[model samples]
Target chain A: MNINWGFIVSSLPLYEKAAWLTLKLALWGISASLIIGLVCSVVLYYRIKVLERLVRAYIELSRNTPLLIQLFFLYYGFTKIGITMSENTCAIIGLAFLGGSYMAEAFRGGLESVSKAQIESGLSIGLSNMQMIRYVILPQAFSVSIPPLGANCIFLLKETSIVGAIAIPDLMQVTQDLIGIYYQTFEALFMLVVAYMILLLPVSVALTWLERKVRYAEFGN
Target chain B: MLNSGISVLVEGINLQRLLAGLFVTARIALISIVIGSVLGIMLGLIRTSKSKVVRFICRFYLEVFRIIPILVWMFIVYFGVTNMFNIHLSGELVALIIFSLWGAAEMSDIVRGAIESLPKHQIESGRALGLSFWGLYRYILIPQAIRRLLPGAINLSTRMVKTTSLVVMIGVIDVVKVGQQIIERSILKTPTASFWIYGLIFILYFIVCYPLAKLSKILETKWES
Candidate 1:
């Protein structure tokens, strides 16, 4: 039961490759989710009738279910209906689907914090609806939303671990593959944990820094 | 084709097996929630302790859990730890331990936030009344913090339930695993069985989680007013 340093060293190349794939998936998923979230939150904020209801349902459905099942449905079940997608595609879509609802909730919270008086003042200044949303509302909302949005980013990043289940050969998948092949469970898992820490720690730190940077003085200490 | 898929759901005690799997999932979540809450409350109280070292330790624990994905933790425990220690542990046991620890870390933060959010004057007033430290917590802090923390705790419970789906990866025969088994067995006869099976699982999870989430919202709004 000695530590297999050599084995871990040899696996480094494989781990690096898998880590890149994970990073790629997370980046695409997170970017897509941000756009989806922005659109859905705007619809909800504006109280658009039919689209609002549809968005609400979509949000709940996405939020309540585990990302694993969503990936399963997309990767496996969809083939039944002739909607075949690549593992990477399914992984990205699943991550975005889950992340979007969370990000939408975050954005909605930010949008709601824009005071009614602020909106009226924007209108008083002859700001049109789009102009108010663009100039007045968005800046304040973005500031307010930074922390939760950052949190959603990290959550979605960690969630990329499960995309291994779809055979995407992400970090987790690589770790399991190493374990299965080498039967060096401890060494494989240690590398897995290290890989995640390497991936996540800087993001967490940067987000904290960003959250502080965006904190408005008028919001009070 | 749809009829065959539907029949796959109800055929030969399949529904019962899925129910049993759901029960296992619910049991894991419920037990972990209870244990996690109790431990979390204690850790949270310690987190706000006067001692800096204790608070630092609690913070470190929370950060460790936060940074690592739960799936990795599962692998480490279910695979690595047992192998390293040369001891046997069931997948369900490993899942319970990991989930409880993770939940406790999360719940502790919620507890700490709730307790800290109270006005400083509440503590000052309690001390003025000649209350001991424990007396202050019992009589002044905890009662109020419970109401504030309930919505957050409920939300965490829903998260725990949803996350229990991960146990299947560690070889626990949870609801998701049961669905996978059914689909594999019926895939040839009903190629669309995966659709119906996974869709049912999606709904089952929704049924368990959505109400809890809704209740958390309701309490949050009700108490906000």
Candidate 2:
């Protein structure tokens, strides 16, 4: 296979635009998840019996099913209910909802690992529940949560590729679109792989570094 | 309005085509699992070998598969391989090739984890028994390894079933693609057909994955004591 420098070079503008879109979807998706996850995690942690059951049901349903099916449901379901958003918004919402379930579980796991003795110690000093959590529990939970949380973020990056199915014009969609019109499938798509590598590999390296930093802090003499 | 009843709409999907789609997906998933398991276990051994170069190659394989989304991998192969090689293969065959490659990479890690979690004494004791290397691996190492691999293998089996949907994107007419075609036609032009059809798709995937999940849970409990 002769290298086609011209095709790859011409496709650069499309790749950059798609990469930017993918970045937006991932960044906003992760941000939305943090909000939904914190609320859902707290519900699992502190909700009364009824609310607890609701939370558990939601989490289990979300976790066991494939994300692709969930995206289909959101794309198909929302439009049925007279709620229509742009394809990009729909894709972002779908990712945030699907990714939120995983994030909630991560947060709940982190919250469980926090030592109860410290919370009791805080109470002894007249700290309220909110004060104890704010001042004490969160700081500790963040460290234990780093590795899994980073893993979830990495997964969120990959999951955004499914948005192409809904025609959201993110990285994968752009690659497919370029191939559809150009009749130059392999070259454009290979660049797509390289494009994704450039975006995701740095985040992975940064995550490993972050994990090490947290591990060192925990073990420092 | 896409009425949700289109999957089984009295006229939308003939009984024969629906059953045919189910069989096609099930068969593809079975072949991929069987092939993937054999390949995965072997590569897994290679992955855990002491040689640094072989180990690095295995780790690289695992990492690339781990980060790259399976669907994108599908497109790369579906478009790239067929045109590059000028092969006139069917879509189902193409899907099987790509998915099996993915399964091998993933299941190898499961096998690696299962092997390492065992006590080091097992390997050392087998050597102490004066058994030949092949004999040790055949009888002692693999028996325990089989037991550990069973639960994870079952999980991967279900993963294959769910992932076969990606083949639909390549135009293999799997369950999702069947539903998609129905919704695009005359009776299903509205929204509900897409919903209910997808709802059924969700149920079908759930039903397939749920039992393996439960069985794995039971097996884990059985192993715990």
TM, every model? 0.97, 0.89
Candidate with the greatest DockQ versus the true structure = 1
Task: Give the lDDT of residue B72 in candidate 1.
Answer: 90
Most TM-score-accurate candidate:
1
lDDT of 1 by residue, A106-146 (tens): 99999998888888989998999899989888888888899
Candidate 2 displacement at residue A9 in angstroms: 1.8
Which ten contiguous residues of candidate 2 chain B have the minimum total lDDT? B1-10
Best by lDDT: 1
Which residue pairs clash in candidate 1?
none
* lDDT scores in order: 0.91, 0.80
Q: Compared with the true structure, what per-residue lDDT tens digits does model 1 show for residues B1-225?
A: 666677889889999999999999999999999999999998988888889899899999999999999999999998998998899999999999999999999999999999999889999999999999999989999999988999999999988898898999899999999999999998788889899899899999999899999999999998874
Query: Model 2: per-residue lDDT, tens digit, A7-71?
Result: 99988988898889998989999999878888888888877678788877776666556667777
Model 1 global lDDT (CA atoms, 0 to 1): 0.91
DockQ of 2: 0.52
Q: Which ten residues in a row have the lowest lDDT in candidate 1 chain A?
A: A212-221
